[model samples]
Target: MRSYAGQPRPRPLPARYSRQELPKDHLVEAVLVTIFCCMLTGAMALIYSHETRAAIRRGDIDRAFSASRKAYFLILFSLLFGMFVSITWVICVLATLYAQRGP
Candidate 1:
């Protein structure tokens, strides 16, 4: 349709940007790691993960980022601690077996 003289054309609306840089909520991973590793850390991680989603829903970008970082660190710490405990347990078992086999 042609605009008559003095009539202004309608401008197109700007595209809405998405929060693509936000971290993913790893609730399941946190729960699984907590079960296999340390329960407390895992629980904390799960909490943070849930908080991240909640913050996102609430449109609190800073809170979401903070929660996401907390969750990530908790998961990592839990995994590392779990691995350390397992290694120590294995070493103790090996030492016990060797001591028992003394000639």
Candidate 2:
């Protein structure tokens, strides 16, 4: 392509396979964040499971059922939180890439 001054200009790289790759550190950070969230969720589940079982063994059916319901809600919340973090991270990476290209 011709430049404004009549000189040949280099073509811009394609977005899908551009020379500018996402930084490795950013990818690692995202992965680490995801893993951390998962671990937290798992720990919470374990705690809830143990509490529910204990309540059940004590003949407190109401307490055990309540614990079970709480556990389900906690799991749902965890899933949503994790998804939000992951999507935000992806958006951040994409924004960084676009910014690097100078608008």
Best by TM-score: 1
**What local distance difference test score does each model get?**
0.85, 0.57
Question: Where does candidate 1 stray beyond 4 Å?
Answer: 1-17
Model 2 Cα lDDT, one tens digit per residue, 1-103 = 8557773444343455333331111223233433655657645655665666565455455565676666665566666788888899999999999999994
For residue 96, give model 1's deviation from the true position in Å.
0.3
TM-scores, all candidates, are 0.80, 0.57
lDDT of 1 by residue, 1-103 (tens): 9867983443332234255666688888899889999999999999999999887776666787899999989999999999999999999999999999998
| Model 2: CA > 4 A from native | 1-42
At residue 96, give the lDDT of candidate 2: 95
Instruction: Tell me model 1's lDDT, rounded to 2 decimals.
Output: 0.85
